[model samples]
Target chain A: MTDDDLDLDLDLGPETPPVTPRARPTTREAPKSGVPSAKVMAERKPGVLSRVGSSVSGQLSHISRPNWSFRNFLIVLAVLVSLVVLAENWAAVRISFLGLRLELPKALAFLLNIILGGALTWFWLRRGVAAREE
Target chain B: MADPGGAWHRLLSLLQAISQRGLWATVPFALLVNSSITVLTLTIEPDGSAHRQISVVAAPYFRDQVPGWTRDVRADADWDMAWAVNREDDFVYNRDARIAALPESGEAAALTISDVAQNPFSLYTTYRWHEVVGYSYLYDSDPAAAEATNKSLIYEITMPGTVTNATVTPATGSSTKTEGPKVVFELAASQGQQTIEVEASRLRWGYLLVLAYLAAYVIYCSACTLRHWLRIQPRKI
Candidate 1:
């Protein structure tokens, strides 16, 4: 049945309900704000595209920031550069300088560079971590 | 109140993150260890064949028989000799072991000294002998009082035939011999053992180094493969 028809047939009491309106303070909670409030949701799962997008954006944010991660990136880059330098200057590295000349192979030269680079990396990283902790 | 499951998930994610970064440290270390092992392996293995055919001619030396009527002098000695060949001029030898010293008297034959030293400055020297086996012999006999004077001989080899390139049909046709220097030999039977000392240079060691490196690399690769397999096992399971 329609509400109006029900009301007309059963108008038994004049006292019903009272409604109030007032100007709220800043701290006071409003019933309907611009942002939707949390509700008992049915838990609609995120789609594949949404998940992928979120991950990609997170990675981008991490990469863009100049932080520890960036320093790590530079460290890797330096290592790569050193590797190239070792490869290109393989002959130079193999040859040792004294009063006379001594020649070794590219393998030995490459090994020396790796040892030096690894030791340096370890020392620098350890110190960096210690400083951060302090 | 919170879900216990959520905390487990976070911890697992953190562990994964740590492992991924940890791999960065381990990978390079593994590579270096593998490479070094490979170089060490190079030191242990033998290199491929180092063979060269070199023509050698040594200066003639005296061979003598003390008492003989018939004496023959011959400078044609067989030279089936071999020594080490080196790309680099570095000398590698067992110092404690006594090796017959090279000719120290007069200036060594240009070919012998140049070849031994691998002196680049002597690149233009015409003579290059790899092996030398040469000798000469003489016989002298005097008849007593009235007996006929017989058998006083000294022979020197001369005019060895030219080693010419000739074409010959295998079965159907006879091979033609072109005219060249006649092989001349005046024979005197003489018995004497003469030893001429020639320098055998230091053995080559580069090949050894290369071989060792190869063996080491192979071992390193095996280790790397093992490490990779071990690291992936947990993931697979």
Candidate 2:
């Protein structure tokens, strides 16, 4: 009941730990500028338009990479030239063949040229895949 | 890293494989086959008979629509005929009122023609004409029915050489008669089939030319393909 007894009682619990203040949860500081918080950025989902834009950019980057060789370029060029020649003299070339008859509109013919050109270019460029396999 | 020279060598090797394996020749072979079929289809008998069809339609288009309609029809018809014939010169379209005089030459004549008009539905009616030469020539509007009605179709064709015998099969609901040098027939507006079998002596050299050209092309492609294959073969040790 005395002051000494009270101090002893308060101090006697050496083995038992004293109640300490709980540590505050660590958090990233908010950006000084008007930028959004990391939580908001993490929580926000990518929109459809943004996703499409990123996908297209990725494809374009893959396609535009400098992986083509001189011979591949030459082959692609030759094929493209042939396609142009075919498109230009389509009627005459068609008539030369007795049974091969095809009549395509100008727009459709141009579209065909683009598709064939893209395909040939892709094939030639991707010959590296064959090299890797070998 | 890839061997820059190796890529070229591989390309050559691939091409060699294509030639040796006859992979690249598939397209040319297919073309040759198609050309052969076409040649057979267009062959003209010694009696100058061919498998051909002539159709006439009453184009229902105003002056403004006539050009577009005629162009579209002509393009379509030309594409269709190109499959069976070698030339488009045989098909003609008359834009004037004047009837073309028969050629003095003794050559076989087959022409599918269309007439031009300011207004097909107007009070003044315009006439369209077509000519075909074969043992049997079918005259119907079903082929061109989508373009216009053939209710008032009239055919005036002058067969080459002396006509031995001409007969119209299923002779019903159609008025057909022979004139001095031509046969005229009026077709019913409704959908139907009518065939005219004419026996006559005519000459056809276009078929021979087409066959020769196709044969030459096939031979050329085959020879080139074979030579390339042989040249690329590795020499024996």
Residues A1-134 of candidate 2 have per-residue lDDT tens digits of 89999989878866866889963343565688967465534345689999999999998887755534446655755665555444433221121257565544444566678999999999987998888888
RMSD to native, candidate 2: 29.5
TM-score, every prediction = 0.17, 0.22
DockQ of each: 0.01, 0.01
**Model 1 C-alpha lDDT per residue in residues A68-132, reported as the tens digit of each score:** 34456457556655554444333321132554444454546668778999999999999999999
Q: Give a tens-digit lDDT track for model 1, residues B1-237.
A: 766774565345334433442111011111111111101000000111111122111111101110010011111111122232222432111001111122223321112333223543332212211212111211122112101321111211111123132222121212223334211111111211111121222222333333454566568668878999998786643
For model 1, how big is the CA root-mean-square deviation? 33.6
lDDT of each: 0.30, 0.38
- Least lDDT summed over 10 consecutive residues: which range in candidate 1 chain B? B38-47
DockQ score for candidate 2: 0.01
Q: For candidate 2, write residues B88-160 as lDDT tens digits.
A: 2332222211112321222223322111223322222222222221111122322344125323234444444
Evaluated at residue A5, the lDDT of candidate 1 is 85
* Residue pairs with clashing backbones, model 2: none
The CAPRI quality class of candidate 1 comes to incorrect
